[model samples]
Target: MKYIVCFSGGHSSALCAIECVRKVGKENVVLLNHNISEEVEDKDIKRFKQEIADYLGIKITYANMEGWEYKTPLRVCKELGGFKFGNGPALCTYNLKTKPFYKWLRDNFPIEKGSIRDDVRIIYGFDKNEPSRIQRRIGVMINQGYKCEFPLAFWDRTITCTEEIGIARPNTYKLFKHANCKGCLKSGKQQWYLTYCLYPELWEEAKQVENEIGYSIIKGSFLEELEPKFARMKCKGIVPTEKIKPQTFWAMVRKEIPDKSENLPCECAL
Candidate 1:
């Protein structure tokens, strides 16, 4: 009997929450947030989550990933393999987000993972502009046998009916182009360049982690190889056609920049 809205306080997610409130009333709409501490620093996501809740006058709950309180995407990259999601699901998305939130739902509501809970409808923040992203998520939900809804599916603008009251924007909105992870391992070389240019300390910390754990954050290229401009070209094609130690392989990777497309962030990065 709960209407969960994935509230990230971003343009699309925030608007979607407001729409949910309008449809189901504030009492039924619960703002479910997955707050990433942004690794190297605090992004102050709490402040924005509060703004969204206050503006909508809805119930807000912060979900946490058990045993992963200190784990960021960068920190998880060094565990076994490099920063590749592989052909299967990305562990970071499951560990950092989906697992904790769904566990909360099952504990409070009358629903389970595989069973279709007709009473519980999850509301997503996808807009009409991104049709493919919307459908992709819908397909995943269908396969999982979960009931979901997109309240903003037909909406096009960032400012919705609820934001008409003149609520202030979050300060962290200016930190990145998107309101996702700060130094996400899924980021491409161009994104890595932006991360280095915008937050060198975060970028440097990732490199230090890579060197310490003997695994690059990216699949083939290490963070140290994330060069600017022409450096992007050098970081690619580092894995030679021979077997070598992980540390030696990453060291060799730093000798050249990777192709811009090689490390592009996947949809789950958001």
Candidate 2:
């Protein structure tokens, strides 16, 4: 049986890949990933992916959309004329990631469209802390006719597999909790503000996209509307780190900018 690990460029996924290789050997393991544009994805994420591939003696298999190479999330929003579909991830995620992956599986395997395959087992990187997410993923994968494995969820201890293999974690983790696109459209004000501070170009593009699509990334507040506020906070040197709680972060922002009593909501951009 082949073990197909969804090798997202993060610590948990990295550990999952390593453990999969250890169990079934590299030949039977596939490190499948979807490529996002460098403008959004950190360059170090690619480096870390390559490094992990080398460590496992396997090549990284990319399943990016055929004509969407180097396309940012904003580009997808512009082309699709929507940011998301009814409480799901941003359209770019479905177009750039989910679509291509399933296409690759169907094209390469004997599995027919909407059919199940017993030969391949899908793997995810959910850790034990995420029981809800893990259960949800399992249900989804099983419904799609694939068995799933989440090694990190059952592992005895947390492992920074990259460090064990003498590689540094992607620098994006220092700035954000996950190594997702810098301006992920699914994110809310907190993430967008962080993007405004750390990646102004992408933030500018997001603002432009919002204007074009007539939809705000944060439902009520457009990125353009929040720009001046974000700029003020940036000027005041008040950017929240990844670990800061939303309540605490907003409280501090309000304390600094006393004129605004509005608290921004946030979701994990990943």
Candidates' lDDT values, in order? Answer: 0.64, 0.81
lDDT of 2 by residue, 37-59 (tens): 77778889989999999988999
Query: lDDT tens digits, residues 7-88, model 1?
Result: 8666667778877666668888888887665563235555666777887876578787654657776665556345545575
Top TM-score prediction, candidate number: 2
Residue pairs clashing, model 1: 234-256, 234-257, 235-256, 235-257, 235-258, 236-257, 236-258
Cα deviation of 11 in candidate 2 (Å)?
Answer: 1.5
TM-score of 1: 0.72
Model 2 root-mean-square deviation: 4.9
Q: Name the weakest run of 10 consecutive residues (lDDT summed) in model 1.
A: 233-242
The lowest-lDDT stretch of 10 consecutive residues in candidate 2 is 261-270
| TM-score of each prediction | 0.72, 0.91
Q: Report how far off residue 227 is in candidate 2 (Å).
A: 1.3
